[model samples]
Target: MIEKLAINGGKPVRDTYLAYGKQYIDDDDIKAVVDVLKGDYLTTGPKVKEFEDTVANYVGAKYAVAVSNGTAALHTACLAAGIGEGDEVIVPPITFAASSNCILYCGGKPVFVDINPDTYNIDVEKIEGAITVRTKAIIPVDFAGQSVDMDLICKIADKYNLTIIEDAAHALGSEYKGEKIGSIADMTEFSFHPVKPITTGEGGVIVTNNEELYKKMLLFRSHGITRDSKLLTHNEGPWYYEQLHLGYNYRITDIQCSLGLSQINKIDEFVKNRREIVNRYNEAFKDIEEIITPREDEFSNSGWHIYVIKLNLDKLTCTRKEIFEALQVENIGVNVHYLPVYLHPYYEKLGYKRGLCPEAEKLYERMLTLPLFPKMTDKDVEDVIRAVKKVVDYYSMENCPL
Candidate 1:
């Protein structure tokens, strides 16, 4: 039954290796960085404000605060939201470590919730059960660029007086219902890593409608120092500033902002192209019995960050690790999205144990992220599909024994 396997020496799908996700930097992106290099005030400058305003306008938010990276943005947002020691923030287990790490950064605890098996997002129903007298906020991640049910999340937040910080690192161009993601939550954080919808090398930003939170985030991004006269404690001279609160040096550079501005101009095209790729992948994999394509929530128009598939291990004769190795042998660089955050050693040390979120643990074992980036050509998409089919066919129970 295992005769069809690639390990027995069948030809691989492609001649070269393909990474799971990649950045697409055009000539314009390079020129934008070059222009920033020639300009004065590389950090804390006009370019940064321009990029912030552009994103603010795009996402329909009143204010946007640029920061060093996605994790920094999360931390600053938590700080602005008044999270502190003994506070508890509700988070989904099926997300990047930073989503929960930011809570710890503020001396707060993370109360993990499981995910909806179909959407792979935080289950709103489970959230209310986890809320306690110390509950402070909810950080629902838009995992894989699809927005969670914002209306329901907002309703829950309002009922409990909890702040909402949507972790939109994977969901820049995504929409919840007809509204853009950034404007719905109290504060939304976005990442500009190479693998994101846009590329700025490495950068992140937080957008909000609250003026008080906006100003606080600005102070937190740059060592908590404020040079404005209105915010100062005294009428000290030109170079005088006040340390308003304890904050971090999480400022983003003008070089990164300039590149981000250029990338923002092409966001529509980028999102459209990514959707096209996702559609093709879904169509190709639907008929295969060994896989389950990711399901997009009906209320969302996803930005399509990573194209993840769930292997139907019940129908497969080989293990997930075996299939992963088979894909690598075919030069298809597949990867796993996450292991439940609590399962990480650091969280275990914090007293979080396994079986806390059963669905997340189950999802982690079966999920596989494939190559899906805006710059991938049609041939690249086809090559990935072909490789997946080859691996699945070889491991099918009909061809192999369990």
Candidate 2:
């Protein structure tokens, strides 16, 4: 009843994981990176700037600042958005930790909000209830590559004078109301980790249309060293630079940017493949009463970064853990997308308690991400379908189906 995965199953899980998520690399992706390696600049250089522009143009943003990693992008966005000590940032509990961690980095407290189980997004209706004088911003995570209800979230932010920096790490190719995820949010952060829709090996970028924030992000990307002389009052010398504020060394290298550029070319291809896989999974699970499948809203299109399934806990004859373990025994590797951020011991020790976000806690009890990636083939898809079916049938409370 609690979980379907059996930990002590007396069987090895996977010699090599059919990981819940992973990256795909081709010869061309390799060649572009090699070309950068052969070039003169490796660290934050011309290619990094080029990569920023490429992403900006693709997402319809005025500026993009490439950073060392996704967490860095979130941290920089937090600072640029004017979040700091004594501020309270509203965020949903159904997200990866960095969404809240970024707020803490600015000495701000993250106010956890529950999500709408249907879309698995931060419930915009709950925003007004969470807001207080200390509130600084609202970070709505686009869970599973589906853009959160941005229009409503923005409307609430406008009323409260709060910033909305979308935690769009999983939404590169996702769209909301036909507008790209990156373009609609006041500020959106993207990850180019290998497992993401686009891979830069390990990199992230912040995209925005606000000019003042753009400059601040540029300065923050490289240890707060502003080389532009026009902004400074005194011209010390041609080589002079100023550490305008306490920033970080969160710059992305040209080598990574080269990989990103190459990956950009295949983004549409990757997205198409992921969509096909999700469709396959949807059809395979359509009639199974024991499991509830993923739901795609009529208004939004997901990049399908993850094909997460929430178990019909009330219907399943077997525990959630048993199903997970059953699949693992057959080498059909599966993983959970998250344990609610507030459920983590660190969050609990920080005074966050259970029931703070009831819906998210209930969701964490059953949410599991199935294997999904651009590289999956027909055989791989069948393997997963067969594994899940076998597990369900074998554990049926009724007589097993043939």
Candidate 3:
């Protein structure tokens, strides 16, 4: 007989709740932050440059610009790319709203693209069809830590003379065709939020190989005010600066960078642990007819930020919400990654309507993220698996309640 689910008052598989994603902070990380707090600089200091250089070296990029948050990083990238009114940027709807919101921030229209149902990244085949004379760029997001089809995306961008601003917030440690995600795109953005692969409390960075773009991002990160002697048009003396362009105060703090420096040192290990957890989840759910595990392309090694499972609603009597709540009852902190960006009320009022991307809306209805983090132990992984299986089995169509 199948075990009763916790939603129906059965014993929970876990006594404590497990979060979907969390940062693994150690003593070293704390020490680093504290050291920065006691240092000579706090905001625009040597530590900021040090962190940028470290990220650049790690991702094999020519330069990196640390910013206050992921959204700021995206906005800075848009500014550097010269996205403006009447310009169109192609983006997938399945990602976080910030991915497309950055375009709107720059007075550009974000053209929503559907995702490949399997990989859940923007569909390469349909990208070209979205291109128009007004199209200036494509912001392909590396969803759920899996790198988007960069090779195909590059080809499309080259053919259309469009810039590629890859949103790699979930893919800092991920790899595509042996190259790191940051080094592949024209400008790649990374987030250092607490739940990300690495944590800086709240921080972000943009890395690029083009020096021109790099300098542009640097100015954009610092209120467009540059004291650089080379860039200033007129220098009164040694204490002169210029605000050449309109920019925001997107600068990141040295304290955050200090934490980031420590966190990045363990990124490989964190990624390894996440992948191992994903492997376990995949193995346990492979034979369950009510579930469809995430798929990774053979050419990619995902950083596995969050493990999401798609429910086979056809085989289950319960809705995704029912299953989500059921898992929560079993102490699993299951959550939805996103609703389609354009489906949000803000975007809806902006003239975007439903049925914009059929595939994304469908996937959003069926998908939910599972707990996958470096700190989760073997027992925690098993608890998640057991609770999921219990909930799914109880809700299976064959076991429909009277």
Highest lDDT scorer:
1
Model 3 TM-score is 0.99
Q: In candidate 3, how many Å is residue 12 off?
A: 1.4
Q: Model 3 over residues 152-182: C-alpha lDDT tens digits?
A: 9999999989999999999988998887788
Q: What ranking of all candidate models by TM-score puts the best one first? A: 3, 1, 2
TM per candidate comes to 0.98, 0.95, 0.99
Say which prediction, candidate 1 or candidate 2, comes out ahead on lDDT. Answer: 1
lDDT of 1 by residue, 38-152 (tens): 9897998999999999999999999999999999999999999999999999999998999999999999999999999998999989999999999999999999999999999
lDDT of each candidate versus the true structure: 0.93, 0.86, 0.93
lDDT of 1 at 77: 99
Q: Lowest-lDDT window of 10 residues in candidate 2?
A: 1-10
Q: Whole-model lDDT, candidate 3?
A: 0.93
Candidate 2 local Cα displacement, residue 65, angstroms:
0.6
| Local accuracy of candidate 2 as per-residue lDDT tens digits, 148-182 | 88778888988889999999999898888887779
